[model samples]
Target chain A: MSRKLLLWLPFALVFVLFAVFWLGLKNPDDRIIASNMVGKPLPEFSARAAMPDRPGVTSADFTDGKPRLLNVFASWCVPCVREVPVLLRMQQQGVEIVGVAVHDSSPALATFLAQNGNPYDRIGLDEGGRAQIEFGSSGVPETFVVDGKGRIVHQHIGVVTEQDVPQLLGMLGKAQ
Target chain B: MRRLAALALLIAAPLPAQAQDYAEVALPDPAQEAQASRLMDTIRCVVCQGQPISGSNADLAGDMRRIVRERIAAGDTPDEVRAWLISKYGDWVSFKPQVKPATLPLWLIPLVALVLGIWLVSRRLRRHH
Candidate 1:
């Protein structure tokens, strides 16, 4: 009876471990832990102008007494294209957006904006993608809410959906 | 045998280069390059969760490798680079998690489990004896 109980215990332990692993895998949201950039001043960066008609953006622009969204995007990132409608909605609602084009080639960006409608007021060309990394972004489609004082108030990882608009607006309010 | 040769050739070509991003650092310092390589192994590829930047081919991992090399070339010590990354991405980016209030339980729980496991086995052995 004791030997039987010991044998059962190993199986029970294995079953419990497998059950825990399966439970952990059920969560599909893959965003990493909250960004440490929140509440910190924006990292300094200067890039070539990606938008032909607009001045190139820089860290200093965030201090212009206007709360704005700084979006990191690229022609290669699919999720940035998906978030276009949400960005358009924000633009229509009077939100000023600064776009940073990672690994930018001006012609590709011009075509991308012409096809998707330009939502950016100031666009910077981060040709080496160094500025995006300085922003602590893992990939494109990452947005930062910057206050009038040049501090990063919030960070949104992955694609921003319609549902995320309300929280983004709320953060904008706080940025005010 | 031809299929086997093709398979081996496929493995021999381009695959290893993909595993190690060989974007030659223009800087003439081998020591900095070695330090950057070591530092890359200690940072997580944020988008790919469990894989370290050293072994991942994911785009973010490539970006991370570039950043590691650039910083090391720019004269930041490995500790400074680690601090900067941790400051931006939070503690989760480090392969070696720093000892902090939040991580104390994570370190202790494994030891606690091991002790409990040993205790259980010893109890079972005593019962058999």
Candidate 2:
């Protein structure tokens, strides 16, 4: 608390704040989709089945002891249409994908799946999109890599292009 | 001619009517509706960088508005509704962050700056007096 120390304190604080800003700008990815729910247990959710024959998806589905992708999408989402093939490719590699169709009509969703080929292991319909909010999704086509123990390891916001597949796989590989 | 050009520009730039999805025209109880609207003003649109859900016409913001109204109409207080959103979307969703251990600095820095400014001003006033 000396006068000399006090004189230097403001500059030191400004320097620290500048460094923090610089570091944040250095890695833009972390700030792109900030979520407090990352690295935490996936919240519980249940929604009606999008398909008639398949059972609806629930939080209990993830407890089956396998790592999987919980994807929030809608038939109305153009980006969701674009990502269909990538999801299918992931499925080909034995990735388990659970789908939650948000703010969509069941008939329209069925038609979308029929046209694009369904890649989901199980599908759920989020009528009000309340379930999507629980997943901390900013918008449609957000994906969470849930580990075997049901912890959300990583989330990919926005369109999941082909390039993101490997990075997502790497996250799943790193998760216990 | 200038007014006509301005009108043309206005008509040419189609409004974002489609983006808002009409937001369901159903009106709820007047008191509850006002409460929900106020709450929406306080809640930030998670998808939007810094805008409140009430101001955003984004689809997700529309969904947030619906949920806010639904919860409030179902007898939840505004604080309870906000707490529920925070549970799902975290403190970032609320423009007014609750006073908690982690947010103490965010809540106090402005106050500290204000107090310092006032003290400096008062010291200058005393010298002048």
Candidate 3:
């Protein structure tokens, strides 16, 4: 190799390293821990009813020939409260939503629903958070779009804003 | 001064009692418990982001620790337990990356850098001599 080319190699290497780091840092999905359960069948588990009035959620509920949104939420999560109105709006559009109330009790969820207008068709109380973990959910307020066969078609982290409703609807439409 | 001390006690009293749910108990077999603890150190706490479950105080981490102990007590090898967690949380949950095609670059980059450094140093030294 030429002396001039060799001299420039170190600078080129530094520039390449900088570009790689910059691209990694700029990636929007960098902070999001992608779930391994997407495209897989829902893990078999049963959760008791979060509130007496609602039915308990089970894996069998999703296996029926009807796609639905499985919302993992908690009464204590502030973002879950923010997400309620959007979920209610989705429910208005005839989107069936099942819920896993992570580490929450009946009274707390009952109060939450009364305040925010219940959107869940069925709400299961995941008192130990085991069901949430089995679903590959890291935290509260994550939503999974499950198809008729019970495969997780999409996993959405964080509160679903008004802007996200159309995208979710699209995913749900495709899921069917 | 007495009122301030009373207020401090009230605040501090609940701190230790809060959210130490599943991790409070260890496996009955000391050998199994030791294996569980070792596995816990290698598993990242998803909620805490990079801290091991053994070091994290997060409720989820506590649950993970409990799962580890239970699995170990049931005769699961540490590798099997790690695989179970990785299956649920993805490879991100494991601090120790598995040797696979996707991770080849991660495993090789350091070796590549070392080789390049040695070649460069040897070239420079030879020229000086």
Candidate 4:
């Protein structure tokens, strides 16, 4: 009986390997890079305004006992256009948004906000995407729920659609 | 002929801009440049996912390369730079995984399999003889 089981060992190993591979295929972890910056205090950096009228953003801005959503976007990004209405709705609900414009020009961002409607209280220009890296953001259209203490509570990659609005709001509420 | 010339101009227009990106800029010191180049190969291009930062042409990768070169030029050791990147991007950014408790199996499995194979082969050979 023991000898017979030993004969089947290679087959068992192969089956186990195949199962792991199949599970990976079923639910791929390909695109989601878990940010190390989550639960950490926001990196110390200040950014200039991406528009003429809006004020610049800084790390000190978040510690004023208010939890806000920090949105990383660019005028050139298409999904940011789709995300504007959802953000505006959130803004209307009394949620303050802090925007970081990575690799964007002031004129382009001004144009984008003019067409889509500006929802940000302050818009920071992240030259050369340095601030995005500090925030552990890989691409544009990422949202972070920053707590009153300036710690990043949650990171939402990709476009924040209507479906994600409630969850983000809930996270923000609990961030205190 | 006019359309062909216009197409050619369009294709050539973006080349210089790409060539002037951070990845193309090298550190003044040869030793520092070589160190930065090696570090780039180990770092993942977060935007491209599969390719290393050195091999990727994505804008983010170019910025990362520039940061690496700048940090090296500013007197940071290669390990320090790697640690800094890991702090920002997590261990996923490095191709070489550290041998920790969770990754111990990944490090030891091949050696264990090799020993097992050799033992099984020797045992089978002895039995056949």
Candidate 5:
């Protein structure tokens, strides 16, 4: 082989390999299309609630009585802020909305509620995110529909819209 | 070939030690820890720009970790924190950009270019043959 060709061969091989690897990697932003977890029992995990002028409350305190919507949110998350109005609307329609403040502070949460208007019946403070992982949440603005039996019926990732309400209600069997 | 072999060895040697260190950390609250880990996976490291803080070892990632802990501690709420970050850094701070008119091209350009490349190559091959 020509000397030029011999020197160029290794570079060409490396380039091709790099290109293949780069192309093969999946897109980072691809939607996480979850398998059916509907009709199945929810994961057993306890979460604390953000109490009024107090430390906070726990999942043990609010898991009983009625089926509820557990919304995992944070002040820093944009999508979560976008979904707040939708959640407020749900709360207006008598949807039992419980908040899980993941990795946030009490005063900041108090301020957030003061500014945004609190829609949650009970808010769980998962400051360290210990409770969040058990629920299999990868990020904030995750909503879970928990049945009266304390089983999670549905999980919504990203900003929830008004259009999602009927579907959420349908899962809860509250939709007309 | 020799250089490549040496590079591979260098890369492989550190990974086991790092993995061992990760495993050795005693996670008192596994659930909360997992949640923090998951959140890190979605949030882009400010300094790295392209990679998530979960995958990044940059000093900025550590700052982001502290920020995450603070937000969770302060009860700012996850959604609010994401909004704050986006407001501060723009949508690029998010590992996943929302699909919109502006971002559609980012998704479609690759496929369009692939098709064009194939067509051009086939045309050239036909002419050569």
Candidate 6:
């Protein structure tokens, strides 16, 4: 091969490798499957009240006889805000929804709830994120559907949507 | 000319160490800083492409670090803060994509590439022999 061709070959190989690496990395699906805690007992943890409208609501307040949906959220989380309408609709449909505000301040969370309208039956504040860790969450806006026995029957990661609720409800057997 | 070239090489050699030294010296709140650093390992710096913010020396990564620190200091929980970042930047900001339709390719492409690579290599070897 000519000297110029030989010099270009290494550069070409490097470019191909770079392209492959870029494509592989840019594709967002390359991730480990997070642990499926669905159909398993929900981990127990206590948190302070977070409801802006009702400051008295605590973790103890969530233990009613009905099935409950525990949603981990934060004021700063955009997806959590996106899913607010869905959760609000669920609340209207009489779903027992509990909110866990992970790693957020009372002021910011209060403002968020005030602006968005709170959809939770009771809200819990996980100030230090200890409670979130206990629940095996890596991030916020994760929803857990707890059965009457407090076992987690379903877990949904990322933002919840109107479309997702029907499937979630089906999993919980709350659907007709 | 040799002495001048030697000086240039020395200057280039210490550039990375100097940069590292700056980072080490500028350490802020150790606890929050460590958490921010850990977050960098897990979070893909969007502007820097595939590299984790922790591993990248990109300007975007530094900006992300600043953002992470700001959220943490403002009392956003780690998960909440991460989620916030992901939301603002898209799930692409996360080194590990949350399972979703848009991100299915991220999980499958690597395996597909691996299988194709192995198949091609095996076919080439077989033909060679």
Q: Which candidate number maximizes DockQ? A: 4
Residue range A75-152, candidate 4, lDDT tens digits = 999989999999999999999999999988999998899999999999999987888989989998999999999999
Model 6: residues with Cα > 4 Å off, grouped in runs: A1-33, A52-64, A174-176, B1-129
Candidate 1 accuracy as TM-score: 0.76
For all candidates in order, the CA lDDT equals 0.82, 0.82, 0.88, 0.90, 0.67, 0.69
Fraction of native contacts (fnat) of each candidate = 0.69, 0.53, 0.66, 0.75, 0.00, 0.00
Scored by lDDT, model 4 comes in at 0.90
Better of 1 and 3 by lDDT: 3
Ranking under lDDT, best-scoring first?
4, 3, 1, 2, 6, 5
For model 5 the local lDDT of residue A97 reads 82
Candidate 3, A118: how far from true, in Å?
0.9
lDDT of 1 by residue, A1-176 (tens): 99789768868988999998898888643666566888989989887788669989889988877899999998777778888888998999999988998876888988888888888998999855668767888777889999999999988987889999999998888897
Higher TM-score: candidate 2 or 6? 2
Q: State the weakest 10-residue window (summed lDDT) of model 3 chain A.
A: A25-34
Q: Write the per-residue lDDT of candidate 6 for residues A59-172, one digit (tens) a residue.
A: 344345467788989898887889999899888887868888876778898789888988887777885555554455556788878776667666688899878988877755
User: TM-score (chain A) of candidate 3?
Assistant: 0.84
**Which is superior by TM-score, 3 or 4?**
4
Better of 3 and 6 by DockQ: 3
**TM (chain A), candidate 6:** 0.75
Ranking by TM-score: 4, 3, 1, 2, 5, 6
**Between which residue pairs do clashes occur in model 6?**
A29-B106, A29-B107, A30-B106, A30-B107, A103-B77
List DockQ, one per candidate, in order.
0.45, 0.29, 0.42, 0.53, 0.03, 0.05
lDDT of 1: 0.82
Clashes of each: 0, 0, 0, 0, 43, 5
> Which regions in candidate 1 have their CA more than 4 angstroms from the true location?
A1-33, B1-28, B109-129
Give the per-residue lDDT of model 1 (tens digit) for B96-117: 8889898999899889888988
TM-score of each: 0.76, 0.73, 0.81, 0.84, 0.50, 0.49
